[model samples]
Every structure is written in C-alpha cells, then in structure tokens.
Target: MPLFVAQYPIGINSHVEAIILQLEIGSDDVCMLGMYGPGGVGKTTIAKAIYNKILDHFEGSSFLENVRDKSGTFDGIIQLQEILLRETLGMNGQLKVCSESKGAIAKENILRHKKILLILDDVDKLYQIERLIGGFDWLASGSRIIITTRNKHFLQTLRICHSTYEVKELDDHEALELFSMHAFHKNKPEEDYSNLTDQVICYAKGLPLALSIIGSNLHGRSEIEWKSALDKYKMIPDKDIQKVLQVSYQGLDETEQDIFLDLACFFKGIYKDYVVDILNSCNLYPVIGIKNLIDKCLINVDQFNKLWMHDLLQQMGREIVQQESPKIPGLRSRLWCYKDAFEVLTENKGSDNIRGITIISPKLAKLQLKAKCFEKMGNLKFLLVGNVDTCGDLEYLPNGLRVLDWSRFPSSSLPSNFRPHNLLVLDKPQSPVILDKIFEFRRKLEVPQNTKYEDNILMDSHSHRKLSHQIDYSSKIDFSHSLIKPLSTLHAFMMDSIMDYEESYNIIVTGKKIPKWFNHQSIESSISFWIGPKFPTIAVCFVFHLVPLKDSYANNDKYGSIHNDEICWNCHVNIFTNDHTQPLTLQRDFYSMKCDHLWFYSNSHSKFQRFFRNMMQGDRNLVEISCKISWWSSRNKKFAPVIARMGVHAECICHPPNSVIIDDNSDYFENVDDSSDDN
Candidate 1:
C-alpha cells in the first residue's frame, strides 16, 4: 500500500467533524459523503484530510485530482475505470478498458474488496458523477465514495444516498493560529507585534487561503512594514482575499505578472486560443512561459480552454496595471456603451483633448458629445463609430478629424453638414443614405454650368480595378439602450458628409431588406451623374455571408473573410476571382466603358464591400460609409486609360427637376429635340 500525504487533523471543527463521523458503517446501502463550497475554499483539502484518516480501515483507496478539468466526453468513464482498477484491483500499468460485453467490471472489482474509499475531487457538473458511478452496484458493505465540488446544487441533484456538508471559512482562533505559523514562523504571534497581528488576522477574514498567503508574505518582514501592510487592508473594498493575495503576487516574474494583469484587467471569460493569439502578437511567449504561469498558481485553465482568475487575483492584477501606467483620460479608448460613454464625454468636452476615438455601440444620445473635451483634441484622427439606429441624429464633428468610419454604426438618414474632405474611408454596412444624400447634395452643390456633360456616365457590365484597405481598429460596441436609434442617425450623417465633400470614396452597406428610398432609379443615376468630380470611379461589392473561421474574436488569425460578388455596371462587366483578393473588374469597366463612377445597392442587413474600403490608403481623400440599404465602391484600375474628359459641369450635379418652358407651346417630343440640340 502507498502512503498518502498527511494533513492537519487536530482542532477539526464540529461542522466538518459531525458530517465525517456520520458516515455509514457496516450498512448494506453504499455510503456517500459530499463536501461542497466555493472555489479555493478548501473543499478538496478537507476531503483529502478526512479520506487519509479513514483509509486504514478501507481495503482500498483512490483520489482523483482535477476531474473537472477533463476535455473529452469519455472523461467520466476513463476516470471511473482508472480509480476502480487501481484502488480495488491493484491494477498497474498496461490496464485495458473492459468492454460493455464484459460488463460488471466495476462491481466485480469493488466486490473483491471489503472496505474501500474513492475520492472524486473538483466535480464541476452532475453528469460527471452519474456517468461514473451512479448505476454501478460496486461497493462492499462498508465502502464509501467521497465527492467534493464547488457547486452545492450539483451535490443535491446527484440523487445519491449521501450526507451533504458545506465547508465554511475557519474561525478567528483557527485562522490566527494558521496565520501566525506562516507569518511569524511560530504557533503564536511575536510579542512586539501582537496587536498588529490581531488586526491582520481580522482582515484575513478567517479564510485559510488568505491566512496562508498573508502569512507567507509577511514572514520575516519588519514591524513597521507589518503595520503598513495591515493599514493597506482598509483600502481594499472587498476585504476577502485581495489584500492578503497581494503579498503572494509580489513574488511573480514580470512576464507572469503581466499575463496575470491582462487576464484580470482587460479580458475575462476568454478562451485559451484567443489569449494565445494576443500574447503571441505582443511577443510575450518564452519557453514554457504559459505552462509555468499555470504551475505558479497565478492562472487557472479550465477543461474548456477558458481562463479564470480569483476575484482577488483579478483585482490585484488591475491594480498593478493601473499603478504601472494609468490610461490618459484624453487618449483613445474603445467605448462599449453609448450612455456611459456619452456620459463621460458629455461631462468633459474631450473632443479637443482626445487624439482619437472609436465607439463600438451605436446608441449615442445628443448629450454625450456636449463635453468640452472635443475642443482640446486638435490633432484627433481615426474615429470609428457603430451601433446606431436608422433615425439617430449626427452630433457635431470635431475639427481635424480624419478617418470617419461608420461600419460599426448603421444609419438610414444622413445629416447635411457632415463634410470632411480629409476623410478617407466610409462603411455603412446597412444604410444607403450615403449614396442618396450624395446624389441629392451634388445637385445642391451645383457644379459650374460651363463644363460639357459626358455621355459615357451610365454603367452597364463593366470591370474596374478597385483598391482595398483596412480602417481603424476598435472593439467597443455601443450597448446603451437609449442610443440605438440616435446612433444610427449619427452614422448616417457622418457617411453623408463624406459623400458630399470627400473625393475618392469607399462605402460598405449590409442589409437583407432594401431601404424604401433606395430604388433602381437612384442606383442608376448616382452611378452616372452623381459620381464625385475629383475621384470618379467606384466599385460596388456585396458580402453574401459572414462566417467566423474560429469560435472567438479575441484572436486576430481567427477571422471571417468577406466574400463579394463585385459588379461594375458602368462598363457592363463582372469581376472574376479565384480568391476575390483584388476586384479590378470595376477598374476594367472604368477604362472599357469610359465610365469613372460606381454605385452599390443591396437589401438591408448586408456587409458587402467592407473589405474594399478596409484596404484603402490612409492618404487618399476618400470617405468610407455604411448605410441602411445602399453603398458605393470605386477605384481607378491601373490598366484603365485616363481620358481627357471634357464636361460642362452642370449647375446641379445631381438629377435636375423638370420645369415647363415658359413661353413655348411645344409638345413633349418637340421639346426633347430642342433640349438635345442645346446639349
């Protein structure tokens, strides 16, 4: 028989002692004992202590560590077979899984032993127990199965004939004793600091983990240092484990410490692969660095690849990061919700102070931007906005703003004054207000009337080479309940401003239903007469689907590639691509049909043409927009010939309103000849 690790058995409290003493002895019904508590609360520790004390009476015993961390579906069966085989049958290496046809393996193994002990520790779910030992009539008359778990409800639902015991924090005396041994290196506190010791114990809150950590941290430290440590407890709001845990955290390496802080301060409920990607991107990997982090007990990787940290540990990490480098208030920070963000922005007009901004959620109410911060940020660039509803209004834009992106916020209507010439890319992803507003605004801008009208503006089936580029990166999505509609309007206004003022534009719109205002006529006319003067070519691409290549977004490599069917109607052309990387098909049309314009329209809820704008150059005088139902894409093909185009710029660049000739009684057909002759 193997010798098990010895544990402290003296001073066992009545709560745990009573439960242990009530175990069924010599009963025909199998005896089961369940211990449950919160994570890191000593459920597993206590179970081992009790099991070792009683194992002498048992013919066999086995302990399973971290059964909750198993990965596959067969973890329960494999665990059960291993425990029964080794403990009951004394099976060593080269064990075989007994097939179901050779059933009763568990019963046979257990029946062979008179008294046995089986400990299943860290049982996360009830299915683990039911699959492992529920139906097995394996135990002899005096045998016992001891189970330990964090979830109390799991034990109750097990339907086992087991006595349940809830483990709690140690009392003050026991906690003091534990703390003194670790901190003072003795069973009692030193005479010089006895008073401070008591206060430390009080802050430790009778938690065994807390006592051990604080004790280990304070060992051999000076009296003044001890007093400072004790006083620091007052600063801790959740006086459970954070203060005590901080002592242990001081010993970790810079890298391990950094990984810890990132887990705590930035990402939670993140999968392992995603964290790996981020860590790798930061060039933080060293030999066995992550595994060493796990071994140090700074981080915990669960069976499902999810990483978790203790609340205290998380707080400690956040503090470390904050202390090292506090985020500047005016620097760009990703925003998640509109109300909270607007509240912050509204309180401080950070528009001037903030160098860059990215808003993820769409709901920005009017008051959020009222802050005086905007006036201070004169060098601001890269504003990414999203999560707005269709009718939301656009707030005022800060001057010197570059890269006005709306892929995050989709809108139906555009504000009139949103003209940013330096703007380079616009992605609506759900609204056509950009194209519509541009068509309407161009007519309102009224091109000089002396330029000659070009006849080759209408698009057929043309191919044009279009450039692609990525835009500003941000993860903040607006989560405000009040800003959904307003945010949409805000996006629409910005996108419209781009179309009205900027030359060189790339717009992405996504939706399943077309907007009521975006008709076939608008698509045709905008592709022709409404193309911008400085940059006339546009490529319209549609993203038919968006499927995540991986299950998580935190990973950069895990991405959903955009699939687009790019069309250049001006030159009556279609782009053919084996990979769809470069949609120069529209560029082909720009040269072939002598058309330098493009317009895109789709049903509501489409994400087409996003990739094209994402790949554009930052220096280009362009606008990237997303709208409710329509978008535009255009790029001059390298192969397209530049024509010396002559045009009498129309007074109104957009479609002109029809008015009757004042003095002539000419019929409609006769009037058409006169108009053709004038052209």
Candidate 2:
C-alpha cells in the first residue's frame, strides 16, 4: 500500500469508500471506474489510494502516470502499451508491440488470461485507452480498469467506465487541517495564529492543491510575512499553482480557449444563456465550447444558470493576459484592471490586439480621452465602462463591437459613419445620447425578417388566424419623423422588450402629451373603459412627464413631496370582465430623466385575446380595462413621484357590440361615454 494513502490527512476516506462501492470492487465482475474533477482537486491522489488498497487481490497491475502529458510525444501511446504489457505479463524486457496492430495482438494472446488492476492516471483522450488495453475482453475476469482525468466527457465518450465519481474540494474542517499540516507542520494552528490561518483557508476556497501549495510556501514565515503573501496572492497567484491549473486550459482548442478566456475576463457571474448568445454571435461555437469547459472543470453553471469560475482560475487567466505586455495595457488581449483601462484610454495607448476591456471603478478620478483613442483597436469586440466619468467625442469606435455597455457615455450621439450592425447588446442606461440617432442606426441595421418570434407565432395554437391582417401600429408611425421620436429610440426599446419582458423599456426625452395617433386619451393615472364583443385589436398607451432636479437634491434626500430623476415608478395595467374577474395584468418599472410613453397592443391571436376569450366564456358581453400608476423614490423608497400628467389611450379596431352601422371614419367608442375612475 502507498504510504501517502495512509498519511494523507484531509478528506478521502468517504471518496475511497464511495468509489469502491460504485466499482463493486469486492465482486468478481470486470468493471471500469473513473475519478474525475478539475485540475488540482486530488483526482490522481484518490485513484492512487484506490489502486494501492486493491493491488494485493489482482494477479497483475500497472499504474500509468502522467498519461495525458506523455501521450503528446511521438509513440507515446505505444510506449504506454509496452508498460501495461510488461507489468501485467511480468516481462523483464520490452515487448515487440511497436504499432497499434501489434499491440492488439499482444493484448489478445498474452494478457487475456491475467486478472489485472490497471490505473491510467491523468488520462485526457479516448485514443489513449483504445491504443492500450483495447477492451475488457482482452483481460481475464475480475479485472478492474481505473482512469483519472480532468474531463468527465472523455470517459463518457469511451463508454468503458461502469461508474464515474466527481472528486470535490475539501470541507472547511478538512481544509483547515490539511492547510495547517503544511503551514505549521502540525495538525492544528497555534491559538495566536488562528485568525490568519482562517484567512488563508478562506482564500484557498477548499481547493486541496491550493491549500497545500500555499501552506507549504508560507511555512516558517512571520505574521507580517504571511499578511504580505496573502495580499500578493490577491494580485498575482503563485506561479507553481497556476502552472498546475493551466494544464486543463491548455488542453482546449483555439476557439474553446477563447471562450474560456472571455468568461474569465468579462462574463463571470453573468447569466450563462445570455453569455452564450453573445459568444455565439461572435462565431465562437459557444455551445460545444462551453460544454467542454464545464466537463474540464474550467467553468461551472450554477442552478440559476449563471457562470462561475474559481478565483484561482480567474486570476490565472488575467495573469496570462498580463504577461502579453507586462507594462503596456494596450498590448494585452483583455483588460479588466481599473487602472490599466484608465491609463490605456487616457494615454491613447490602444492596440489592435486588445479584444475586450472593462473598467468599473467607483473611486477612480474622472478621465478624459481623445476621440481617436479607439481608432487603432480595430479588433475590439467588447467594451464596458461603468461608474467612471469619461468625457470624449468617441468619434471612432470599433466597427466589429459585439457589446458596448458604457454607462454615462459623454457624447450626444454616436458618429454618423459608425456601424453597429454586429452589436448584440448596447446597454447605455443613463446615456444622454439623442434618440433620433439611434432610430437612424436601427433603420440601417439589418434585421432578419424570419425571426424566432415569427416562427413561434406560426407554430402557436392560433396558426389558423391570418397574421398578415394583424395591425402593426409601429409601421404606421414614421419613427424617424414622429413627435415622440426624440423621447425614445423605438427600435432598440421594442427589441429589448421582446428579449426580456420583465425588464423595463427606459428612454430619456422631454414631452408632456400622448401621441395624437391614439384614438382614446385620458389625463388621469388610472382609466377604465368598456370593451364590446367584436373588438379585434386593443391598444393602451401611457405617457409620463418627468420633472428634473439638481444632482445634490436627488442624491441627498430619499423622499420628498415631488418626483425627480432619483425616483423609480412602478407601472401596472390590469384588465377584467364586467363582473370584476381579472383576465390580464402587466407590470413594469419606469426610470430616467426624460418623458416617455409605454404602449401595449393585443391582436386577435395575442395572449390577452386568448385570456379574454377564456375569461368571458359562455355569455359575458362586457370587458373593463384599467391602468394604474404609482412611484417611489429609488434611493429612499419612502418618497413618491408627483405626477405632472398621466394619459391613457384605449383604441378598439372593430365595431361596438350592439351598434348596427359601422363607419370607417367614426370613433368606435365615442358614443359610449364613461366617467374617469382614479384608483
């Protein structure tokens, strides 16, 4: 038995027992077992322990170490084959199996009769197994083959493993013990050093290899030295540990590696599906690449489908980019450090190699850059600047940008010649840019007519309805020339609403009245109207006029008698039958310093229509639509916005229920007058 198996102090007993049970090692049946996890998670250590415990029972055994690394060399597979053959057959000299065919012959003729225990350590590829033992039939009964790898997909592809176990990081107790064993050369830390020891363990984050390496490196150091080391680890990880963890990253192909680096640099903690869409638009083959990364333990997706990477791995990725240009931020492939990005922008030190940059600093001083700072960064794809006050013309932006999430962009409008056709996300929440420029940009943008929404409509239950006859109010309102055009970018706002219905449609503009196209209008916050039976289309529009205040007043006070830019309004719309049975409700948040109008439409086949039909089943003849508005100060939550004016418009396309004569030019609901009810 290996001495380390007995001497290894932390967690492994449960893992060993579980693997033994999963493999059914006690039974006399041929089985294959796999131990898989991220690099430095002790996959190899556990496999060795299992191998040592059961070596006495097998007639022949061979442990192939570093198979992933050695297999990359010339004839590496044949060399591994020879080791397996020599050990299992008890041969003194090398075998004659130079080629794959000879190796198959050797396995069939000699090793078939022997009961063997073979452990392939750090195996990464399928060909390594196929070129070595070939199959379980090549060995005698009761034989067990164990493989250790960083990727579980490798075992899945081979289909040889009867069972696979994922090796997890140590718990807090075990991690402290293991770390103390090396740091203090004891099982527990001294009473005076307990706090510092806990800090180290927390930084290690339960990774056994990191705890071991860090403990060993900091052994016999003073308290001051320990603090300095921990601080240093935050900025630059230990080179020894980084090298071990980077092997899995290096195993990825070029495109997979790019996805990994991007996640590490920019997208960590973001929703996984959203990241996939962005990367897929970049032509990165994200679906397969992300799967491989997860299999290799390079990244993880939580239950909420958010991407997460270990802190050590994230640091290692940033370090790799840092090495590209030790002093020059412009030469690096990605930049996330606040100081580095600030310097790159202010000094106009951008290069074509810079693919992505993110600057988020709440404490950094204001910065101003020239218009041509990004002119040379032709390959830039992702750019995000947050919290920092950046002032520049932004005359030159990379044409191939996929995401531009610059909050507080100083320019009034993007350059006329600048192209945004490749953009997947343009998130400028508090930007002062004019909406007309955005409308023009959207007009120039190429949108695929056959989008997934259209496909969904075709496949829906209302496929029999003629979608062509559905009225599209957006087409009739010349967005470029409309009065409301200055208040909102119609295309981008609509696209955002279509993408995520829960999120608010925010825009900054100045207006006081609803558009004239709406047939029905009211000045109250809440409006109720009666809907007849034959109405095919129903549209509701709400207009809000914002009152601006000084920055200090908005920031200092939480709740006052008036509303300002700091207030966030919660808007709700509900529809019910005449009997007060609710059929539909819509809620959204409204924020910004400009006047804006929110519009909602329901056609013959829309969800509202379906719900209305179901709710008004049998002989229900009347429907009531109600709109309500309330606001609270986002900063204090106690203050409410004072409504300058709130307007609602309800338009019905078809005739009233009992009206016999239908005039194309006459209003459908003009004769049915009802008092405005405010809630």
Please give the clash total of every predicted structure, in order: 108, 0
Q: What is the C-alpha RMSD of each candidate to the true structure, in Å?
A: 21.0, 11.9
**Least well predicted 10-residue stretch by lDDT in candidate 1:** 464-473
lDDT of 2 by residue, 1-679 (tens): 2425434547887888888888776777888887888888888788878887888888888888899877776587778878888877777776766686887788777657878889999998887776677766676788888899999888888755478889988999999999989898898997878999989888888888899999989889999999999999988889889999999988889999899889888887665666776788778999899999999988998774667888888888888888999988899999888889888888889999999998877464577889888998999998887667887687888888877777667776667677766665665644544433432222322212221110000111121122212212222222232221221111112111212221212232222222333444544444444455533344445544222222333221111113332344545667676565555776544433222233333322344455666555343245555555533333333223333233323344333333222233554334321111110
lDDT for 598 in candidate 1 is: 26
What TM-score would candidate 2 get against the native? 0.71
Assess the local accuracy of residue 265 in candidate 2 as a C-alpha lDDT between 0 and 100: 87
Q: Per-residue lDDT for 205 in model 1? A: 58
Candidate 2 clashing pairs, residues 3+ apart or interchain: none
* lDDT of model 2, residue 59: 85
lDDT of 1 by residue, 1-679 (tens): 5434323322345644676677755465678887865444566667766776677777777777677655134644675555656666666765555652233455465554556777888775776655555453655677788887655555667665778777766778887788888887677898997898888777655667667767777899999898887677544433446554564355457776656655564334444553554454334572345665554445667764556665556656655543432444333332323543454454563534343454555444323343133445555554555554323345445544445555423234444554454444444443334443432223432322222212222111111111111110131122232211122222332322112122333444332111121111111111122222233233333222111112223111111112221111111223221223454322211101111222232111112234344444333322222212122221221111111111111212344223212122223323321221121
> In model 2, where do residues sit more than 4 Å from their true spots?
1-7, 90-103, 362-364, 439-679
